[model samples]
Target: MSPMTIDSPVAGTAPATGPAPAVRLRGLTKSFGANRVVDPLDLDIAQNEFFSILGPSGCGKTTLMRMITGFETPTAGSIELDGRNVDGVATRQRDLNMLFQSYALFPHLSVYENVAFELRVRRTPKREIDDRVRAALELVRLSAFADRKPAALSGGQRQRVALARAVVGRPAVVLLDEPLGALDQKLRKEMQFELKRMQREVGITFIYVTHDQEEALTMSDRIAVMSEGRIQQIGTPTEIYDTPASRFVAGFIGSCNLIDGVADAATGRFTIPGVGEVPVDEIPDAAPGTPLTLAVRPERVRVLPDGARTEGGVHLPATLTQRVFLGDEWISHLALDSGIVLSASVPSGDAARALAATADGARVTVSWHPSDSRVIPTGELA
Candidate 1:
């Protein structure tokens, strides 16, 4: 296949001007025999941006990152780094570093030696290497542990040492492939903020690949959701979460309740087969009677006693089937009259306590404002 030019701007990224983007891909594609792992795609990552490639396993996210790092060759199209085409560049000469989930720290080497390994290989002057290594260690807050070996440090600290090594050379960009996947939950959360702080302090472009939705949302300046070798959506975390471009995005980014029904445009409502019509803030531009799907986040739903009045809000009859306590909040599961199950998240307070007091199978109503629900076309429900 020949390289194709991309005239339109990449999704969720501004058009490039002034200085070129930190990374650019035009019609980048990869295939192995009959299997296409990455379809032709266009994207631009700005300098100093914390970008994330998010998707489940086998969704081509890791393969795409490898192609960018020159570990895997693309079947077609081109890649540009800092406006320099690097289609055939060797991995080491790409002016970038990659940090893997495994610390990859030399167990026998001290933290300082491990961080100084790259410069030593390049025959960097001793004085310059010392200065850069100290700066990198200081940036990651590992200066005090410079003499410790990998086994002597905690998981988080070892990861920081690996991070210091990756950035010690001051590479133009860093590709992190689930670098925090090995840490404990609490340590993972701590390192998320630490990674963000290091990124800001160093001002280097970071392309993180992960399947954790919360992790991506917490650290990314922008995210590209991928599936079936294609980009499903690209936008800031708020845009991707609040205004998902497709049904896949809405359901994948967070916990959402999807309701399929036909749109009654004339009445500005959506009509579910047995649950009745519910008011919607904006009816899609399709003609009346068009099949559509409404997505509502669990937190937006409220569980109330049966026959409760819900003026100016959409409500549906349901039976409280189960309630789960999740430390900070409670998740109540309700079975709608139409056989659909909806979940409502309530903070651990009077409202949640009241809802939990209700017996299993108690009749109840679930309600939410029309503005909190998003409408999607039925055809895009995948």
Candidate 2:
């Protein structure tokens, strides 16, 4: 409602330089009656960048995307497209296209006709429409199936046709809301790369929204993790996975073992209630006895034989409670004497075979490098 202004750069947003971003949000807010669906938010999606908004159901990801598309009016804040404010613009007038989970293809229309539908509605010249339709079909690798109807195509092919149609007009931005959700797992995985390739070839900005973490990680140039109608963190896949900004981000993005403890800056250690203190790389700038949470990825945890020699790492004794094989990798669940469970993932090979041979309830030692674990203030940004 107020004029959009940035007194300071929004956290995790790209620095304002070079060209204007494809999409920008300042103090964006949306609500239904007294309940807020999206909180005051600020974000910048760069031109031609593949950005994803990821969160669980009811986390406001869909609402946020709808606001950007002009379907839902924001209770506050402004939506900018290529640096132009479009707060009052109708959805059809915005320079963007959206693809939904449902292919939404006309059952009786041929693939070529589906891709040409938008251009036809715009009343483009016949020659231009033909060129664009062929190009769009070719881009999605559906040229050969141009004559096929949607009912005759595979789930993946129908999705491709939907994508071709969405991008046929060459809108500056394409918003995909879980477009691959209807496909089988294998097909969904395959489509992830296809979507990325299509975006790059078209050189169009893509704003993807999904609950699938792997989908976002594989296709997005950057990701915004959301929770409770607020953004938890924004960063590249590696940054979000390796150095999560909050406990929620750490646990939500991947399988992370979280341990609550108190920081002892003087000793450079974290003191767990039941388990003893463990070495930590750095301590937060908080007073002594401040609660902190240590986050360690399952792959980073090492399961060693009890009393095994460990150097320059935090080690604790535990019992091997369970081992689950996942083809390429094995997950070993170890329970500490304090009743805390930690999981270790090992590649399926000699080490994994050896771990599998270890009997359940056998004493084992779990160790991890201090550098591999991240410490954040407990309950901060959760």
Instruction: Tell me, by lDDT, which candidate is best.
Output: 2
Per-residue alpha-carbon lDDT of model 1 for 54-126, expressed as tens digits?
A: 9888989888988988889999999988777887777776768888655578899999998888788778899
Off by over 4 Å in 1: 1-17, 285-291, 378-382
Task: Write down the lDDT of every candidate, Cα atoms only.
Answer: 0.86, 0.87
Q: Lowest summed-lDDT stretch of 10 residues in model 1?
A: 1-10
TM-score per prediction, in order, is: 0.91, 0.94
Q: Residue 154 in model 1: shift from native, Å?
A: 1.8
| Candidate 2: residue 50 Cα off by (Å) | 0.5
| Stretches > 4 Å off in candidate 2 | 1-18, 380-382
Give candidate 2's error at residue 374 in angstroms. Answer: 0.7
Residue-wise C-alpha lDDT for candidate 2, range 117-210, written one tens digit per residue: 7677668899999998999999999889999998999999988888888888888888888888999999999999999999999999999999
